[model samples]
Target: MASKVIQALYNDDDVLMHAVKKVRAEHHHIEEVYTPFPVHGLDKAMGLADTRIAITSFLYGCLGLTVAVVMMNYIMIEDWPQDIGGKPSFSYLENMPAFVPIMFELTVFFAAHLMVITFYLRSRMWPFKKAENPDKRTTDDHFLMEIGLHDNENELADLLWETGAVEVKVTEKES
Candidate 1:
């Protein structure tokens, strides 16, 4: 069956946030939202689950720290020991101060890069992927909310219009 949805466009994020709250309060099902910029608290308003990106970042940081420690230990102590500033490279713990900068840099680097990659993958935003937004204006200055149609399109549209939507549209979409 061809699914139907209502698209509500708002000129301001504040209006969109309010509309989301109103829609949720009335027990409407919102499919998705598109915005030109990040809207704070929109996820909470939409009742979305908390994100786990921070946990992934911490894991990536741990992996990076482990790599740095193993690589430094092998290179400085096991492979080719160096003598610098009257310090012998005998133990990683003994020369921990000198490796602090490297450890910190690698940890940050891995966390940042891996987090970006994970986000892109999770969002299905890989390279060369086609855009999925219904309106081009949503990428510029408009905020769009998509709500499922459940035999009450008119009522939903009216409510959306009352919520300060600049434009409201009902369209059939393939399930």
Candidate 2:
């Protein structure tokens, strides 16, 4: 089905934030917002749920730690024991101090890389993906708010303008 939507553009993040609040206060549903940079508090203002990336990051870190421990244990204890600085590779527990830095580095590396990959996958963003922003200006300096139409295009446009939108246009979109 085809639906009409209003795209409102704003010059400043502060104005966009206020406009979002005003629009939500009137009980209108917002489709999406595009900004050149991250707008702090915009997620809450848009009523989006909290993200679960932190939990995934912790899981990734644990996986990295496990890999590092198993790898070090096999290489140092069972495969080929080496003596460095008069310290013998007899047991993992006894020589754990030397492995602390490696464990920490692996944990951080896994968490950072995996979290980025997870974010990209969860957001449906990938290499060579087509751009979705309707206005090119939004990628540069402007902020855009899209609201689905319920046959009140004029009212919504006026409200957007009053709430500090620089430009408002109604367009039909296919779902």
Candidate 3:
């Protein structure tokens, strides 16, 4: 369904940031923001909570380390022995020096790859997914803020204009 929204366009990031803060100060809900580049402290200005992706990344790294250890122990120590430098230890701890590089590589690999996947999924982005940007100009040098339209359409537009928005208009958004 289509919903009414107030689209505020700003030519500068600073203006957009101030407009966001003003809109929020008035207790207006911000539906979305489209910016050409990342705005510093925008999440805080939007009153969003801190993300927990770092925790997931740490877990992924741990999993990778476990997989590497198990695979190496079964392969080089139990299944088929490898005598590096003509010395056969037959113990994972003894052969740990040689396994350090593999362990480190796997840990970083899992953390990086899994974090990327998690980010994509969490952001609702995937292969062949359509873009959600409301305006094409947002990809360039403009910032657009979409505020859901309530009974205060004119009030919001006036407030946004006062906050230095270059343009403000009401439009129907696809929900």
Root-mean-square deviation (CA) per prediction: 1.5, 1.5, 1.2
lDDT: worst 10-residue window of model 1: 84-93
Candidate 3, residues 1-175: lDDT per residue as tens digits? 9999999899999888888888899999999999999999999999989999999999999999999999999999999897779756577898898889999999999999999999999999999998889889999999999999878888888898899988899999988
Considering every candidate listed, which one attains the maximal lDDT? 2
Q: Which stretches of model 3 miss by more than 4 angstroms?
A: none
Local error of candidate 2 at residue 69 (angstroms) = 0.4
Runs in model 2 with CA error above 4 Å? none
Better of 1 and 3 by lDDT: 1
Question: What are the TM-scores, per candidate, against the unseen true structure?
Answer: 0.93, 0.93, 0.95
Kindly give the stretch of ten consecutive residues in candidate 3 with the minimal lDDT sum.
Answer: 82-91
Query: Across residues 56-89, which tens digit of lDDT does each residue of candidate 1 receive?
Result: 9999999999999999999988999999897778
Which residue runs of candidate 1 sit more than 4 Å off their true CA positions? Answer: none
What C-alpha lDDT values do all the predictions have? 0.94, 0.95, 0.92
Model 2 lDDT per residue over 1-175, tens place: 9888999999999999999999999999999999999999999999999999999999999999999999999999899999988887898998999999999999999999999999999999999999899899998999999999897988888999999999999888778
